[model samples]
Target: MPAPSILSPRDGSNIDPRSLLSSIGEVVYSWDIHSDGLQWGPNAGDVLGRIPEAALNRGLAFAGLVEPGSGRSRYDAIVSSGGHDHGDGVVYRTRYAADLAGRKMWIEDAGRWFAGADGRPATARGVLRLERQVRDGELGAAGNDVCDRTALIERLEQTLGEHLPAERIIVVLIAAIDELTRLNDDFGHEATDEIITEVQDRLRSVMRRRDHLIRYSSNRFAILLTGCPQNQVEMAARRFSKAVGQTAIETGRGIALVSLRIGAAVAPEFSTQAGALIAGAENALAGAKAGASDTAVIARRRQGRETRADEPSLDVQAVAALNERRVRLALQPIVDAGTRQVAFQEALLRVGHGMDGPFFATAELIPLLERRGLVRLFDHRVLELATEFLAADPRLTLSINVSPRSLIDPEWLDAFLGCTRAAPGMSERLIVEVTETATIADPARMAGILKQIKDRGARIAIDDFGAGHTSLRHLRAFPIDILKLDGAFTQNLRRSTDDRFYVRTLIELARHLAVDTVAEWVDDELQATMLCDWGVTYLQGHLVGRAELPQRGDASALLHATG
Candidate 1:
């Protein structure tokens, strides 16, 4: 069925666009940039604070109440406007501080800013949504206490930082309705939506005040338990399972009992990376579903793996390695599954001379380097090495993972941009893979920086796609070219049905967005074939090839192999 036209309803009667939008729970507004006046829809008052009607109507009044340094203001949007786009106006999605009845919150504005006769932004119109409230109402999912995938990533980062490794570990639980499709087939769409909402409420009831419950998928919910011990994860999963599965949910139509399948993985011990951590939980979830009797299953214990004591002068040594040219690029081959040919080689960071030499993996000192603001040097060195390879072999298409810290570093961005600008077609041959786990201060700024790279023809891939905060919305917002499916899914794909379903879902999502997808950790022909059948565009793993050093002149230098 076609959507109702904006000009008139299906009955051919003229309809006010703002009224139509507000009737469906939207707060629409028209702002005159020069006069600082706003014409708001009826629902505007329902979303904003207890301010007087005049204050709410005046654009400056709303601006004054916006959280200071919120970064995205109407004025900023005007200043940063990309002029005019063929007279269609530029669509902008910005988050700003909103005063909501004596409380402060971020509100998301999705609208278009039009250029005036002089080509400066003159008028704007958009929909306003409470950032938190939109996570549900806009997405049409769970409510209040339930967060989205992005918030889950952020909370995980925060929780991981607050709790020391020596203290209790964090537990990530992935719970799904055993067969939600059956419910959809039994009950109608509206009824099923209510059932899922009730299921979320039931799950939230069993969770502690400090824990977080996020809607992971259509039927899956990701629960984050911070400072939870390794031994306590299973108990918590079982408790969650009983809370949802044992009780019957009263939907608008009828009562329905739901069984929750839960899989859990511990943090840092499982993996410090958010994408990897969530992937582990997902792997366990697949395992739980496969096991006939187990409603909840904790991933096999990777726990109790001791972290080596921090070397007192390792930072200094790593710096010395960087300066002395000990740091080298280890190019790993990512192969195309169908042809089994090397599609591109990923440039990995390695610090050492040769085999049996004093070797240092990039991970060991990255946290320290980032904390001390020394990662810029490492990024520069890696880029230097990768660029050298690119210059040497024009035939090579290479990928390099960059830290979020380096993304914000002016010197590094300049150097990277320079490398791409050095020669024609250089950026086209290079793929910048961003580590999803790293914290990016301003994603918009990062997007702008990426746009600079992309405008020069550089490709961008989201490394460990599932583990990070890059959602479908982000995929659109950022100039992303590839979605690298988190390795954890492929690692369990051959044996886990849930992983198979998820891999297909991700591949389909990428396809829908017209973005290519790459599946990592393809350990065998079986996995490769499965991925190929599922429409995965690229595959990378030990099954294809392992990391190797670039071929240099005989006895010229050392072979540096890295992750």
Candidate 2:
């Protein structure tokens, strides 16, 4: 207000005394110099944590506040410089400890000197800011928001400077304020405020004196642990997780437990820059919250070479090589329980290195293809191979397992139909088997897709029918021509009377719906006889035949066994 201070250099001015002051001080500080003992604004008192009158009373003199050894020399240099005309400007830094609210705090004073018209050195005014906070063992009650942020920053810088010189630091923030939301909804705003206040108190108790903790959002709090290594960050995260898990706060009505999902990102791993470090940590936290697990999710910048070890490895090149007409087909006979005559044969897809090696079954190959999103490709190939296999044996009916994903894809459907068209009577002989779990997830969609396949003269069968939560509701909702009961339900029929009863009920239900039923995992002749007695249309398991590639001569053996 007093002639608007102009110690700051003009724009593009060659002189920069501020840079020198910044470099010399432990913390950043700046001042405006003018032609007076100290041309300072009233706000300078606020920066120095003192009243303007009291600060002015102690002005321009080396007091007991400054260290005796260095303080005297600095004062002598300033007085002798009389009027420093190095023309850039006068800048100096002095360290001191000031009594702040009955506690001593280290401060750095940075100021510039200006000359008066009399050619005499005049005012040297600037900021005397707290740079380091010394904490006595007194633990203040929480919810105070009274802690000095600048002092906290200073302490964090000092502590971290000794441990590690991090290029960047990231702090993960995880919090649950569901209790606050529920409180606000039930009670008035007053109760909600109290809950939030309590949450702040709880958070403060867990944090260190140097850590920067802030209300990141209304429901979330953030802690910035400067120079924290990735491992230490993880350890801290786990401790916080355990603490949160153990805490229960009373909200008048009842006690509410808080939950948290933690995510972490390390500096230089995610980013070297401080701002980017914060952002990456936030992203990792989001991922943790999205995942189903309760444990903290730790993430780092994904290196170019990083790969998930848990995911099944697929050799794309090897799979691609086999994509060309290099697949094989096998048929397991589904016999009519009453007649013991071959009713149909379920065609199984197989992959082999060559004619001599062991063949990979449809069960094994299908999962691999699905993981690679190549199920449609494998499905189409199986359909083509089945069509060719069936064409040679015109009287035999063939069932092929189709992955749910493949059946849902419109492109795969068209490709499948095209392959069927190439082999005459292929659609009439084909049966499509889909898993119970896949069907349950989207029953309406599965029904519609299966209807399309049925319209082309192909039969539909539900595989692993009793394996999941498949109830009569599924049967009534979707039209399945065949139900293949899971082995688990039928395997121990003799051991458990309850198992026998459930199997009988399932068989009776299938018969009422006019849906043919097949029993899988019929390990022994005893299981097979029991299943046949229950009126199962077909039976398949170890007793019948293991899945194998079909050869020209195998047809005679299959026919002989069925006959």
Candidate 3:
């Protein structure tokens, strides 16, 4: 469908554009560049606030209607009085004058520049859509309960738009109380509310008189700091983090220690759009939560609105995709080096439209899942699917990858243990593999989780072992059943003596630790032969058996081929 043309003769139009737009939940507006006056459509009052009939008759100028600091320069640069043809469009949020009811309103204005007769930019005519409005009294003293999320965002946008030119940096921090929902479930809503109130009070106490603190949602807070140096901003983030992290809130239930995941973004000098700042902060917050607890990350500039692999973060669609259960397993056999028999198959996740359609690799999906705090959910689903596969094929022993983030999630770990417990002897046939680098955050906690899984008869493997910063100390800490040598070590084993020696040393260390060693990416007979000579128990790669979507009819044949 073609988009409706906004350039339909400005004068002598039989159909009223205002009436047309109002019918579709919009308001038609025009800015006369020469006079600097903004002409509002009939329905503008509905969106912009109930303007007095006298003010509407007098004609409201653009400067008077728009908040002083909001996009004035862009409006001046884009909408020219010289009548030049520039096919440029802008989307921004702005504040307009109050209605008769004396309430401030925020509206999103999006419009394209149009040329006058002289071929110079003359005016910008666009639509005004309401975002949110708040009465002046709503933003009471700091002592009162903070403004709602919508109103707080509106004020932040207004403040940013107003102050961008000052060249002063404003730090926007988005603090999300970690696992607030779990608190609600465990302690009850009353306790949750009390904890939230106490946290808010603590935040208020920590903030300066000039700083603005808002209860962004049930579990998040938005903070705006003006005129703070970069060092001070960093210190402030750490300060708030420590204050919240160390203290325990006294709810009716008991003392509850709450952690915060904070994301901070400095206001861009070139642009002060509140949405951009919030988005940057959001991305940073996600990064902090994905890795170490009580951490802070500075926001990076995004290329555009949508997030892709090349971009710095994930988007709403990617986050939703992880939760939709549109994933399937692709099985690859891990063969015994000497006997050339199938030891087990690794179940890799493929996400897409259907079984045969194009799908995203785990490489692409992992970052997105981690960013949105959905890795645990994805891991949980993978386990569920793996269990189904195991149930269907009693002879099959499967190796599945688990995220370090999921291991730290107490609820997910408990549920996973429960699932493994349900099938009494199923754990013996399951191998849980975790990347070596992923255990860097808190090895003690990860080691404990691995121990619990091991106790249930499941074997734990330190996958990609030689590729990361794994040490002898870590080997001693973790109760690992297998050490999967990284493909990097075996990929060059045939050519490099150092690679061969490293693999030998790792194998000897594994032997001493009483752990089996598996060499990955043993693609050829030569690599397999060499790894086998080093006493590596298992070998995995394309040469052994390429990963395939498991079909019921081919299961027996696959086993025979490996045998």
Comparing candidate 1 with candidate 3, which one achieves the higher lDDT? 1
State the lDDT of candidate 1 residue by residue for 1-563, as single tens digits.
Answer: 21222222232222232333333334556677757778765556555647766668887666655543332355443333333432324544445555566766656454566554344556666556554432223332223444434566787877777774657578888887765545654664457667767777888888898888877333568888888878777788888878877768877778887888787878767777676777677767655654643555666655565646774366787788777777766666777657666778887776763332345533335556777888889889988877777777677788888888788778888898788788778778889888654423566787887888788898988886653244444567788888898664565564445456555766666666678888876767888888887778888876776655555521112212221
Indicate the TM-score of model 2: 0.43
| Per-model TM against the reference | 0.45, 0.43, 0.44
Q: Write the per-residue lDDT of candidate 3 for residues 1-563, one digit (tens) a residue.
A: 21223233432223332343344344545565444456655566555455665444333323334432222222422421112232222222222322334655544444444443333334555544444564555333322454443466698887776666777678888887776545654676558767767777788888889888876434567889888776676688878887787878888898898978788888764237777777677657756765554656878665665635665333344445556756777787888878888999888876654435355534334555786777787788889888887776688898999887888888877877987889888888999999876776788988888999999999999886653255566778998899897664466565445455556656666766778988876668888877787688998876788777656334444555665
Model 2 pairs in collision: 36-123
lDDT score at residue 277, model 3, on the 0-100 scale: 78
The per-model lDDT (C-alpha) reads 0.65, 0.55, 0.64
Worst 10 residues of 2 by lDDT: 27-36
Q: Which stretches of candidate 1 lie above 4 Å from their native place?
A: 1-312, 353-356, 437-441, 553-563
Q: Which candidate tops lDDT?
A: 1
lDDT rank, highest first?
1, 3, 2
Candidate 3 runs further than 4 Å off: 1-324, 552-561
Candidate 2, residues 1-563: lDDT per residue as tens digits?
Answer: 11222223232132222222233221211221221122332233344444344334444332333322211122322332222322223433334444544545655444444343223334443344455564563123222443232333354344445434645454544443433333443553444445655666666777777566654323445566665666687678766666655767676655656655555655446554444544455445545543533655666666676667764344353274365445666667777766667778777665655554344433234455687788777677777766766666667787888887888899888976777667646788788898766776788888788777777888889886643245455666776789997654565574435456556656666766679999876657887777787778888765676545556434434545554
Kindly give the number of clashing pairs for every candidate.
1, 1, 6
